[model samples]
Target chain A: MKSALSTLLQQTADLRQAIRHKSHTGVTSGLVQGAMQGNVVILPADWANEFLLFCQKNPVSCPLIGVSEVGRYDMPELGHDIDMRHDIPEYYVYRDGVKVESRSDIEDIWQDDMVAFVLGCSFSFENALSQAGLTPRNVEEAVNVSMFETNIETVPAGRFFGNTVVTMRPYTPKDAIRAIQITTRFPKAHGAPLHFGSPQDIGISDLSKPDYGDAVTINDKEVPVFWACGVTPQVAIRNAKPPICITHAPGKMLVTDILDTALAVL
Target chain B: MKSALSTLLQQTADLRQAIRHKSHTGVTSGLVQGAMQGNVVILPADWANEFLLFCQKNPVSCPLIGVSEVGRYDMPELGHDIDMRHDIPEYYVYRDGVKVESRSDIEDIWQDDMVAFVLGCSFSFENALSQAGLTPRNVEEAVNVSMFETNIETVPAGRFFGNTVVTMRPYTPKDAIRAIQITTRFPKAHGAPLHFGSPQDIGISDLSKPDYGDAVTINDKEVPVFWACGVTPQVAIRNAKPPICITHAPGKMLVTDILDTALAVL
Candidate 1:
């Protein structure tokens, strides 16, 4: 008989294996219930230093969970037997600030001078939110969380500079308040939302149209709560015009063995 | 040379002394800045039991900081040499749910069977908010917080039943998020807000007019955030129709020696 913790860990490892072998190649949103998922960003050693400074300057938007050594794909700090090159369900290749290709495995393109960075994702906190009975609308609708580019600017580090990208979740004011308290506990996963209520207030002119990801229904009684999105770094990378870069595709992410509770801070 | 804590304690003691001697009859909103303040409620021993149950039923609005034993006026746990009859800056006397008189001291009316209850006030969290640079509008304007009667009802306990009262503070969405995290630390002082945004959603028809306190300015970019108020219990007691009830006038609270940080949990 496996302990509950052991079973959850085993399940997470099994799911990662499926993703590693290309058996599970869809969005990783609702899979492996308690495990933490990460947004993948791989950069050449030269670009990695400036990107690290960008993350330090804008921590709320880019909470780095693990940074692999140059040329190494394994992020042992975040998971067991993790291979960043083959673990993520989907990957996107960027050349000179433009997204040029999307693929499943990055093993063929892996470079000795590249460094892998795993960032804490909002998906990790969704489980905690759902367990608190404040299930986010994106989870209920079974679609990607709505992402919008806000006028709020991110701090510049070297050439990395761009407006912030936020993920919105519609909730009633009462439920939103509880959501704020619950999410504030996970600072590594974007902490609490940057804004709530009117979309225009945050320079998001249209709730129906988003800059990235799929938009969910916003009921009449619900107000949109916006959290700083991990996609923000990608926008900065485009502005920085790094020569070569690779990242996980929009909904797909790397499943790590770390439990969601491990990301919580006081 | 006195320590900073010693000076704050002396200042609080002197202020309480002034309030006790009938020298200070106005509101206690901004005075004795670092100490905990409480809403005063006095009732006969028979009514105290039901009121206690009511406090338990609605702890957010009626956080019990201290309760005097029957016939006792001093709350030693809350402060040294505290006399409930004279500690509050001003007192309201109610007879069968109706206002009878307003007085500076209740020493003459203090009955042998009366029990004095001290409930936590939101003023304590104002210091925490101000320290975080999210100075509440009421503090900035030097006025009582804008309080309103909401449609949200409290849990019924015996005859004590009425709508929950809430205090409003206006802030930009960003500041409100920080305020929420800062105030959540002090659970005994109403924790986080009950709601934010549209006033009408919580039964408040106007932001310019409040039922209990003076309304502060709501800038074009700001949204009004509402927190459960200590006055809620007073409304409950009024509905209960206690034969003889004494309470602190709105904004005039019992200044206790306990530090504001003492109420913080996590």
Candidate 2:
């Protein structure tokens, strides 16, 4: 008789295998519900040190969870048999700071000088919020979480610098407080929110037209709560103008064997 | 050489002694800064059990920290040699749920059937907020915290039932988020706020006219934050119409030896 834990492990392994074989190329949000899903950033070794410093300086936006050794694809610390080159469902390839192509697998472009950085994503805490009976509207509506580019600037590190990007989730003031408490436990997944009320306070003008991802409903009684997002580091990478950079497509992620609860601070 | 702990102990004892002797009969808001101060409720033995159940049902508003044995004036668990009959700066005496007199000591009225209830007060968390550099406006202005009776009803128990009463403080949205996180650490001291933003949302009509305590300045950028107040139980007791009841005068709390941080959840 297979226990629930063993079943979950097998399911995670099967999903990763499907991704590796180019058979499951879709957004990883809401998939493998309790596992830690991450934002992928593959940079050449020459630029990896600067990116690492950027993450340390702006931890709320770029919470680094697992960083692979130079030229290695396996993140053993993050998962069992996780291969960075083919594990993410979709990948965005960039050249000289501009996104040039999207691919299901980056095995052909895997460089000897590449270093893979897996960052903690908001999906981990979103799962926690759902478990606490405060499901984010994006998940309830079965759509992508809303993302916005803000005027709030990230601290500069080496050649990396840009304004922060944030993801928005709407909740009534009562539920927002509970969500804040729940998310505060997952520091690796952006911890608590950066702002809650008026979007203009953070320089976001329109809530309806987001810079990325589809907009979810914000009811009359609900206030939009904004969190520092994983997309922030991608914007910084663009500003740095690295010759080559790769990232998981927005909403698409690399699912790990690590349990989401494992990232909680308390 | 007196260590800091011993010094704090001496100061708390000195303050209590002063209050006991009627030398210090003012509000205890900022006095004995880091020590725990509590709201007081004295009820006849017949009604004590119902009030006890009320506190249990509404823990956030009436977080019971210590209760004296019936007919006993001393609360050893709250402080060394603490005398509830005289340690508070001022007492409000009620006859059939109406406040009839104010006195420095209740020795003449103290009955063998009276039971003294000490509830955790917001002063503990307000001190913590000040320490975290988010000074609550009431503390800054050296005034009692503004409190309002909200439409949010408390869970009724026996004859005790009334709408929740909340204390208000003003802060910018950013500071309010930080305040929420800081105050969440002290569950016994009202924990996190009950509501934030518009006054009308929680049934507060005007910010300037508080049901109890003086109103402090709410700057243009600040949003009013509300917490479940210790005064809540007094309102419930009023509704219950106990024949004879006593409480600390508004802002006049019973100073205890326990450190404010002693009640923090994390």
By summed lDDT, which 10 consecutive residues of candidate 2 chain B come out lowest? Answer: B232-241
- Model 1 chain A lDDT-worst window of ten: A249-258
TM of each candidate vs. truth: 0.98, 0.98
TM-score of 2: 0.98
Find the candidate with the highest DockQ and give its number: 1
lDDT of 2 at B84: 90
lDDT of 2 by residue, A4-72 (tens): 777778888999999999899877889888988898899999999999999999999999999999999
**Listing every candidate in turn, what is its Cα RMSD in Å to the true structure after a full C-alpha superposition?**
1.3, 1.3
> CA lDDT of A121 in candidate 1?
86
